[model samples]
Target: MKKVPFIAVEGPIGVGKSSLAREIANYYQYRLLNEIVEENPFLGNFYKDIDGWSFQTEMFFLCNRYKQLEDIEKYHLNKNEPVVADYHIFKNQIFAERTLQSKQYEKYKQIYYILTANMPEPNLIIYLKAGLNTLLERISLRGRDIEKNIDPAYLLQLTKDYEQFMGKFINDHPNVPVLTFECDHIDFIKNKADLEAIFSKIDDQLFINN
Candidate 1:
């Protein structure tokens, strides 16, 4: 039997994960699953003082993402409907490990594993990445008020964390294909050629090669 495609776009902040995911969903007519970000009440405070609000912020995201995946599993994946998500649930661990202290992270890890044990993993992961300056510029252009107070240092470190995590992810999930794009050179939003290039690669990965 042919498997339904579940594609997740992942990256550090302002790396164009959501935008690319939306484009992919539109092109393929798949269900779009976007991660809730600005809706979190703790987000603003979390940016202002990451240390003070890390636990609350991370917990809220983890719970919400878990619920989102539950719905996807029941209503979409089980029904054999394809889906394209802006963020992968594993990203929670990336942010949590970066922000939370050792004890808090240990506890968070326990909850994370239990909640995600039965979750459906993406068949393909589209990893977007950019230089720190490019990331900062894109973030500023979007001008989300919640992200106004984000520290450059924090964003820089998050990029590194993503790189390391993705390396291990590829090793751990060899069956799941990952297609990475460096966004510093391509502007998918503004250039039709760039967008088409991405779409072509996605097709090759999910359809032709598969």
Candidate 2:
């Protein structure tokens, strides 16, 4: 049997990161890993009062993500099974840093480092990029009640932070291949050709073009 690769998809909210991750996992018969987003007890309140509930929300996410990664490591990585995850574990730091206060962020960083110390990293990363307006439209189309009132300013800044985080990630992990796509013009969710194109890119970046 061929060695299965671990793939991860990342993007700002409503960029169809999860949707595309699902497509890839299905197409390739890889294990699909979805983030535990709405499960965080403090998430709803964090959206209402970011400053007040940020710590609780971040901590909850940290613990959950850590546990998820541990499970993935033991169950999939150890077996060499292919895996595709909607969100990489490292993204925990990006949100925590952006949400938590300085002192809180410092403490969060310490915890993040410890949890991530022995975690497995993805063999390939797919970053879906879309314009702010495009993301807003998609967000409305999805119609999630908790996300309806997301602050535009906060979302905008979060998008920027994601881009910056990817930049630094690329610099830090040069061996890991990252394939970025400008998905504003393509609808991978409904367009088979578009999805195939992304798959081709993944192949090209991580295999063919490597």
Candidate 3:
């Protein structure tokens, strides 16, 4: 039997990961797994004072994401159901490493590895990337009160971190395909052509190329 496709849409803040994930899930009629962002009690504080709240924020996200992925594996993936997630579990490490102190990061890394050791990996990763200016604009347009205090410097650095992590991910997970899109050039949300173009590429990777 052919394996069910599990696609993860990943990127830094304001990169439209959730939007694309939603579109993909709708198009394929697959299960949608969105990360619990607003529910993170530490998130608002983390955006204001990253150093002071980094550990708490990271831990909250890690635990919740682990539970989410666990449920998806049991109720969806194992049952031959396809799923499209807005964020990948590995992104937790990206933020933790960027904000946590060395000792805190070491501890967090240990927990992350243990929790994710047997988690299901995505068959395909749709990575969206854009300029720092574009990211800031999108974040402002969304007007999430919790994200109002986000630091541009931090967001810029997070983008760099994501790029580096994705580079390493490609090398480590050679069998898993990573489809990248430049969000600055393509407005998949508003333009039908752009949206269809992305869908075409996804179909090519998940079906034709698979």
Candidate 4:
């Protein structure tokens, strides 16, 4: 089969995945699919008390993302243009693993794996990397109310897990090209040059016109 006409940008919170996704979508004139965090009613409470609302939050996101992927799959089957999504569906498992107990994780994984059986995978995945301090600074700069209460230690752990997951992902799926960018030295949000560099990466990896 030809490469899937989909691009996924992924990273832990405070990295510029969403921004880069939006920029790529606009630049390429592709459909944009964003993670629907704002639509989830349980998200605020989940942020405030992860132990209390973790399951609810994760399930809500899993269902929402599955629906989005289903819709995107249908769209792709009918069209040729690419789609740029901020978060890949697999990242939901990352959150669930972090939040759920052993039994809960197993149960959720069974359901998630079944639902995503025919889902479309990205042709190119852009994984953003940032140090804990830089992530903290970006998180503070964003100024989301729920995010203000996020513990620094929790963010650090999430970062470590993200790194491990991406490392394993690369090892297991060598055919799927992944471009990793470290955000400590570059500010794509404010610098045109940085944005151009990111666009160049997308072009080189996905567009085939670089």
Q: Which candidate number maximizes lDDT?
A: 1
**What's each prediction's TM-score?**
0.98, 0.95, 0.98, 0.94
Q: Model 4, 92: alpha-carbon shift in Å?
A: 1.2
- The digit string of per-residue lDDT tens for model 3 on 47-128 reads 8889999999999999999999999999999999999999999999899989999999999999999999999989899999
Per-residue CA lDDT of model 2 for 73-92, tens digit only, reads: 89988897778999988888
| Model 1, residue pairs in steric clash | none
True-structure lDDT of candidate 2: 0.86
**Candidate 2 — which residues are off by over 4 angstroms?**
1-3, 206-210
Model 1 compared with the native: what TM-score? 0.98
Give the range where candidate 2 is weakest over 10 consecutive residues by summed lDDT.
201-210
Error of 2 at 153 (Å): 0.6
Write down the RMSD of all candidates, one decimal each.
Answer: 0.9, 1.8, 0.9, 1.8
Off by over 4 Å in 4: 1-4, 207-210
TM-score, cand. 3: 0.98
Q: How would you encode candidate 4's per-residue C-alpha lDDT over 1-210 as one tens digit per residue?
A: 565568899999999888899998888888999999778888888878888888888999999999988888787635765789999998987889998888888999999999899788887889998998999998898887778778888888999999999999999988788999999999887899999998887777765622
Q: For candidate 4, list the clashing residue pairs, or say none.
A: none
Give each model's whole-structure lDDT: 0.95, 0.86, 0.94, 0.86
